[model samples]
Target: MKKNNSFTIRKLTLLIPGIVVAILTLQSCQEDETTELTRDEEIAITENATFSEDVSDEDIEIANSAEIEAGIQEPASRESSSEKCYATTWDAATRILTIDFGEGCVGPYGRQRRGKIIVSYGEEGNYYVADRTITFDNYFVNGNQITGELYVEKAVINEEGFYENNYTVNYTILFNGGTTFTLNGSRKREWIAGVLDDNFANNVFRITGSLTGISTRGISWSHQIVEPIIADFNCRSEGNFLYTQGIKEISYSNSRRKRTRTVDYGDGICDRSYTIAINNDLITITAE
Candidate 1:
C-alpha cells in the first residue's frame, strides 16, 4: 500500500510539471496574437493617413518654396545662352516624348549638367491628362551623375486650369567621390499663376513631398514636409530663394542609432538659412 501511494505521488509530480508547461505555452501563443494584432492596427492607421490631413499649411508653403529654389520645375536650357536648347521629340509609335539635352546643356536650376529625359504616356492626345513615366539617363546633378526613373501618377487638371502632378521619384546619384545615394519619394507639384510664361524672374512655384535616401556611407535620411515649400523668384532679390519646413529623420549603424528633427525655413522671409530642432536642442544651418 505504501509503495502504491509512493507511485501515485510520483505520477502527480510529473503531471503537475506538464500542466505548468502547457499553461505557459498557451499564454505565449496568446501574447503573440496580441502583439500581431497591435502591429496590424498600427499599420492600418498609417495606411489611412493622408498628407493633407497630417501636414500643416506652413510646412507645405515652405516645401514649395524650397522646391522652387532647388529648380526642380525649371526645364533644361542651354548652358551658354538664354535660348532653350533641349529638343523635345514625340514618337507616335511608342507614345513617348524624348527630351534630349544637347551637348553643354544644363538643367533648369543649373544643377544638372547633361542628361536626357524620356517621358512615356498612356495616351497620345493629351500628355498632362494621362499617367506618365519619366526616365533619366546620365542625369547630372550637383556634379553627380544620376540615373533611374520617376513617374507621374494620378495627375489632374484643376478647374482653374492648373496641372497637379503627383510624382513618384526614384534615382541613384553617383557622386564625384564614387559614393552613391539612392533617393525615393512622392511629391506634388502645382504651377503658380503667371509663372509658366516667359517671365523667369517672376516665376513662383510650390512643391510638397516626402523623400528618403540611403547613402553609401551607411547613413539613411528621410524628410517629410509638413507644409508645401514655396519658391518665389522674387525672393531671390532678397538673397534667399529656397524656403523649407519639414521633419528630418536620420538613422545610422543599421538603425542602431537614430535622430529626428524639425527643420524650419526662416520666418516667412527669404534667407539662405534654416533651423533644425531636436527635442529642445536647436541648430541653425546656413548655406555656404
Candidate 2:
C-alpha cells in the first residue's frame, strides 16, 4: 500500500525531536555490566507479544472475509489468500466462524500451523460493529502450542473516521522444549490505514496500552507503550514479524528488586535492529 501522506509526515516530525533526545540520553549513560532480565528472556517476552498480535489480526481478517462471503457485509477489497491454506466454515445460527488449518499448513512468514481458530460474534453478527471472541483448538504455530482466547470489543469509529477497538489478550505459548511464555493484558488498537483492503500486507495499525506477562524463562514483566506502536504488515525482519516502529517502556521485577528499561523499534524502518536502554546500559539488537 502507498504510504499515507499525513501519517508519514507526522512520523517524520516525531523523529526530529526523538533523535536529539536519544543522542543526549545515550551520551550521558555508561553501559551497565549486568541486567536483571536475561537477553533471551527479554526477547522472548517481545516475541510472544508480537506473535499474539499477528495471530489476533489474522483471526479478525478471516472473520471479516467470512462476513463478506456470507453477504452480511460488502466486500472490503479482493478476498485475501492468506487464509486459503486452511478450510473455513461459517455457522449462521451460532454466529460462529471457524478456520481450520488441518494437520499443517504454511501461513504468513512461512510458519507451519495447525488446528482451528473459532470466532464468535455478538448479536449484530457483524465484523465491523460487533464484539468478537476468538479461541483456539489445539493450535500450534511452528511447533509452539498457543492457548487461551483473544477478546475484541465492538469497534468505535474515532473522529477521523477510523475504527478503534479494545483488545484483551489472555494468551500462552508452550515451546517444544517445554518452556512457556504468557501474556495477559488489554491494548487499544486503531485501524489507521487499509481498512478497505482485505489483504493484510497493506494494513497498518497503531497500538497503545500496556501488557503484563511472564517470559519463557519465568521472568515477570510489564510493558507499556509510551509511544504509539505502528504495526506495518508490509514490514518483516528476517522472516520474524514485529512492530515496525514504536517506543515502549518495560519493567522487570523479581523478589529482590526491579529494573526498568526503554525499547525503541526505530524510525519506521523495516530492519531488524532495535535499541534498548536500561538505566545506564544501552543495548542494540539485530535479530538473528
Candidate 3:
C-alpha cells in the first residue's frame, strides 16, 4: 500500500509539468495572434487612408479651377498634365458647379475616373470661404466606386494670414474586388505656401485629420494624424498623388486581438516610400 501511494504521487507530479507547458504554449500563441499585425492589414489601412486624401485633393483642385473659370476668383495657372476629359458647368443662379467626367478619364495621378462631382455653394465666392457641399454622382475612381459627401466649412485666416479650410468627410469605398470600407472623418487643410502666387501646382498645404472605419475583413480601425502631413502638389512622386511627408498612427482591432502601428512617410522626401512599424518590426513599402 505504501509503494502504491508513492507511485501515485510521482505520477501526479509528472503530469503537472506537462499541463503547465501546454498552458504556456497556448498563451504564447494567443499573444502572437492578437498582437502581431499582418502585412496585408497594414497595407489595407494605409491604402484606405490614402484613398480619402486622394479624393479630397481632386475635389479641391476641381473646385478651385471651377471658381477661377467661373470668374469668381482670379485665374490661376492651370498647368496640369492630367488628360482633360471632363466638362465643367456653373450655374450662377443656382450656385452649383458640376464637373462631368464623361465615360472615363485618366486623372492627374494616373487614376481612371468616370462620373460627376456636384459642388453646391451658398453664394458666389471662392471655395475657401463659401459654405459648400460636395457630392458624387455615379463616381468610379480607378474602377472602385466611391460614394460620399464632403462638407466644406467656412475658411478662417490664421495668424500667418493663410486660409485654413476644414472639411467633414463621410465616404464609402467599394473596391473592385467587392470588399468595402466605410470611412468617416474630418480634415483640416492649412494653406501654408503659394497662396499669394496663385499657382495651383506650387500650392502647399498642411493637412491634419482623423478617420474611423470598418473594413470588409471585419477589422475596425482608426487613424490619427500625429504629425501634420505636408502635401506639395509640385513635388510629384511616382505613383503617389500628394502627401509628401508626415506621420500617422493607426489602431486596429479584430476578433482575436487589438494592435497599433505607426506609418512614417519619410522626412519630407519626394518618393513613394513609407514605413510601417508594428510589433517592433519595420517594413518599407513603395506605393504602386
Candidate 4:
C-alpha cells in the first residue's frame, strides 16, 4: 500500500475514523506480520498522534470495558489500544453532591448568609469521573482568613459511574445576624443565587434532588443573596450534630428564618418531626 505518510492533523481529524479502522486491522494481523516497523512508518505513526501522551489506568480501564461499544468490532487489546487515547469521563449517570461550609465559616457575619451550593460531575464513558472534578471553592480572600464548613451531603458512584445528589437550595440574603430566609419553593439559579453573582443565573451548577434539576456555581454576593449549605439531619438521640450511631428524630435551625423543614424521608416510616431555630442563619434542628 502506497501510504501517503504525510498527513495534516486537522485534515486527519476527519480521516481518523478510517485510519483507526486500518490501524485496528493491522494490529490484528500483527500476530502474523512482523511487529518490526520501518523507520519511516514509525515516524509517521508517531507524528500523526491525536490522544494525550500520559494515558492513565482509568483511561485504559474505560476503553477496555467498552463491551457495549457503538461499533461492533472486537475491541483491541489494552496494550494495542493504549496509544489511541480518544477517551473521556463523560457519562449518562448524574452525581449528587451537598457542599457544607463548616462552623468557622458560619459564625457571626458568615452565619447571616443563607442559600444552597449545587455540585455536579460530568460523566465520561459508562462511569463518573471522580478525580476530574477537583475545583477550589475559593474561600480565603487572603488564603489565610477562613470562611465556613463546605459539607458534602451525598456523593455516590453508580453502576454507570456518576455521582448523584438531590437537595433543596436556598437563595435569601440576610443583613443582620438575626435575619431570615425561606425555602418556600424551588427556583432556578437566575432567581436564587443569581442575586449574589450574575453567573449563578445560568445552569452552570447542578442541585442533586430538588425537582427543578441541577444548577451552576457562581460568585457569592452579600447584598442580594447568600449561599449556605443546609443540613437538616435525623438526630438519633439528641445534641449530637456529628452523628455516630443509634440516632433518633432530626433537628435543624437556619440563622435568618424560623422555617419548618418537613423532613419526611419516606412513607410515614421515618416520618419524624422537629422544631427549628434561626439563630444566625443556622437552622439548628434540635431533636425533641
User: Quick one: ranking by TM-score, best first?
Assistant: 3, 2, 1, 4
Name the 10 consecutive residues with the lowest summed lDDT in model 2. 27-36
**TM-scores of the candidates in the order shown:** 0.59, 0.78, 0.82, 0.16
lDDT of each: 0.51, 0.74, 0.76, 0.24
Per-model root-mean-square deviation over C-alphas = 10.6, 18.3, 4.6, 29.1
lDDT tens string, model 1, 1-288?
246888889999989999999999988877754553342332222221211112222122222232233333334230111224355566668866666665546433323345556667666343345676766666554465657777766457767776677777676767678966676778787666443454444445566778776645535656677766665555543445344333333222232334455555555566666565545766665632
| Model 4 C-alpha lDDT per residue in residues 158-268, reported as the tens digit of each score | 454434332223322121333222221221111121112211111112221221111111111111112321121222112222111111121121222212222212221
Give candidate 1's whole-model lDDT: 0.51
Distance from true location, Cα of 255 in model 1, Å? 3.0
What candidate 3 gets wrong by more than 4 Å, as runs, is: 1-37, 75-83, 237-241
lDDT of 2 by residue, 128-203 (tens): 6889898899989888888999898999999988899998988887888998888889998898987777565677
Model 1 CA lDDT for position 228:
67
* lDDT value, candidate 4, whole model: 0.24
Better of 1 and 4 by lDDT: 1
Put the candidates in lDDT order, highest first.
3, 2, 1, 4
Model 4, runs deviating above 4 Å: 1-146, 151-156, 159-162, 165-175, 178-248, 251-262, 265-288
Return the TM-score for candidate 2, rounded to 2 decimals: 0.78
The number of the candidate with the highest lDDT is 3
